[model samples]
Target: MWHELFLIPFLTGLLLAVLLPVLGAYLRLREEWLAALAYAHLAAGGALLGLIGSLPPAIGGVGAAVLAGVGKRLFAARLSGGAGYALMLLGGWAVAVLVAANHPLAERLGHAMFDGQLYFADAAMLQLVVAGTAIGLLVLWRLSQQLLLAHLYPDFFRIRGLSAWPTQLGFDVLAALSLALATMSLGVMGAFALVFIPPWLAFRRAASWRAGICWSLVIGLAAYLLAFSLALYFDQPFGPMLAIVLVFFGVLIA
Candidate 1:
């Protein structure tokens, strides 16, 4: 049942990775809020999944997401870039420590959270995935205008009687939820990388939002397919291999 729930986030992340940049661009978003939203969703999803698994989901997912978000908000104001990278490293270490401390349950849940043997996926996991995907899509559709407005001109949004704070909070919650779900089913490493990398690369290279999304989707699918193939051939972990594939392509693109 849980494994079935995994597919929803996997497909959702893939779709969002491909479409968000383009959507943001279309709506004239100036900041990287869309990207931030995506990451937040991934974090939230991870937390939720942890909770479902009877693990300390908040400690790892919500806690880490909040910490990472706060750190990014703080450092980004001072540093030009690299805040995300720092957060990623810090979050990884934090999760590792927590996992190590929990040993027994961690070992079992870790395999479920990271290894994700797709062949063994069950019906319940699929249902969860579908439900999550539907909810995410609905939220995205409903909030599109507000999100765009907030991104483009936060001050104006405030003036027009729209509170940026609420929007931000909502986005954060949604992001965390999405992340938690994806992490539970797809494996943490693969899910996180999938959420972050492709959009980033597309944003870097593509001139328009549509172009960026199209490129991102192509790249994301390619990365995952390559990763899966490599993992199968070498008997390596799928999540790490997927991340490596993304890195390899990222470097090549760079």
Candidate 2:
């Protein structure tokens, strides 16, 4: 399995294993983890529409997610907290299923998006993941302090006569892009699992914010590798296996 054929997909997964958890740590901090599932579901819908229109699925998915992220920020007053994400999630799911129901090819692609087609990931997917990971890391590095202050004190920037929308919007777009790519590679629930579980576990155990991030990264990477190997060995689906492995890890730690 460690041959030329699997190299690209493996590399894609590895990069996501590093990036997603870092994003997840922040999402968990902001208590906005539901955004992962919302963005993923939207990506699935966009991907299905892309197939129907003969466009690249990744482009459609990422575009839709980024739009939603931007819109959420712009309408922050009305779409506050998880309400906006919930709306996106339901709309996305409805769109995806409705599209799949009418088109045969879209049905298959939609299923693949939810179930995951990691082994079928091509070079384009790997390249996209590489670029996304790099951008995510760079932006996260710069926004670390602002994000920390925002999450810890919600009013830190506001009280000081600064708007927090810019930072929140930036992170929102970054997270939307990250989850879209992960969904394309790891399936909807697989991506959500990575964004939710590791950080949940890390927050319970870590002594500080930095330690939480480190623990989240370690937990995500370990589960990802184990899940990948186990799925390949057992000839099972990757997404479900990854989720299962993560849950088991969560149980062990909890």
Candidate 3:
């Protein structure tokens, strides 16, 4: 039972506890919250590319995310919040669907991305989740203060012997890579799923940034466990079950 029901959720929740809050904080600080969904979509498309190109799905997802991050940064140079992101998102999804249509594994791949077949995850995927989460958290931790300074005091941070534009862009790429790794576990929704609520809950109530981040981790893990039981009782899939439970938790806290 532990192997069947708990393993994937446990791994996912633990990883998210570390990775999600950092991504959320960065997105909120950078005022680029919309990019989360766009990058997730790009990652999904890249997963499709992986299936077609014989690469690891997460690798493809990260590749797509990096490209999207670079393109968005370049385009943002001219027009802040340009239409390029919307186009990239739509084009990515369209391409993924079109490509999937030609392959026999489309339905399975799509189901895995959106619905998250947690019970069927392989050993390689489990390893990916652990390694990805560890790497993502370490990078974010090392850069957190710098990233925050860049976000809040861009000109000042840059004036103090730092390059704000490059730093911000680098953070975005790292964020996309983290999000892509998340997609490997929670599916397409994995990237941004369960992100907004817990972090919002913590950031709203906590006294300091560090405290807020800690609270966010607690909220996410608790929600995942509660949602796991609810999924079993209600006979529902885990991803959407977790989503619903997260919203419930949000409402309760509110």
Candidate 4:
């Protein structure tokens, strides 16, 4: 009972603390923070598809994210940002509800994905998340130099023969994959909070890249701890509570 209810929740929060800040910082710097919500909805929709069709959860989640990423890339030249991302977010969320509408376990699954009940997470699921996050961090670390150059010196790339498409593609794929994994592991709400809140706080205060990420990690960890403690004491849902905690801190810090 303790393991099922407490241990997994704690572990998941810890894992998210370290992982999300890095991913969040990258997204904020890239000006793709809105895409996090988009990918999260896509992951939720894809997870519902997996449930309805008996596919692997990650397959559906990652597939939807990749499709969205590709679509964004293709339509970026045409569609304006606000309209494009808004339509995609609505589409993804609508698909999720539609998929879950007639399922036998609709309520339960919907609650799981939307609420992200941390107590219900299993060890295997948590481990998979940890492994995936680890690999993602490594990939980001490897691309750090190029990503910095691209962000700070777009003209520098054009001056060279570097089209920069490959770098963009790599980052997009990684972000999509990370969003998918996080959605599956942490639920849509949890994933959004982790990806959005920390970075929002980090960017406002930090003077340098390293300082920004460090502060993000600190803020994320605090949010996770506070949420966990509050949930345990008040008998509330961990993910939503964490989101609330993050918002509270965001207000205070802002």
Q: What is the C-alpha RMSD of each candidate to the true structure, in Å?
A: 6.0, 1.1, 2.3, 1.9
> Which portions of model 3 show Cα errors greater than 4 Å?
4-9, 82-84
Comparing candidate 3 with candidate 4, which one achieves the higher TM-score? 4
lDDT of 3 at 34: 63
Please write out the lDDT profile of model 1 over residues 16-122, one tens digit for every residue. Answer: 33333333332224344333433434354445446556756534564555555445544655744544544555555455446545666555655655564443334
Please estimate how well model 2 matches the true structure, expressed as its whole-model Cα lDDT. Answer: 0.92
List, residue by residue over 90-141, the lDDT tens digit for candidate 2.
9999999999999999998888888876887889999999999999999998
Write candidate 4's Cα lDDT for 52-137 as tens digits.
78886667888989888777777877876656667777888998888788786654666677887777667766786788778888
Give the winner by TM-score: 1 or 4: 4
lDDT of 3 by residue, 138-254 (tens): 877877888887766767764677566666677778777766766656655545655666777777788998888888888887887787677667766667777777788888997
lDDT, model 4, position 142:
84
Q: How many clashes show up in model 3?
A: 0
TM-score against truth, every candidate: 0.65, 0.97, 0.89, 0.92
TM-score order of candidates, best first?
2, 4, 3, 1
Report the candidate with higher TM-score, 2 versus 3.
Answer: 2
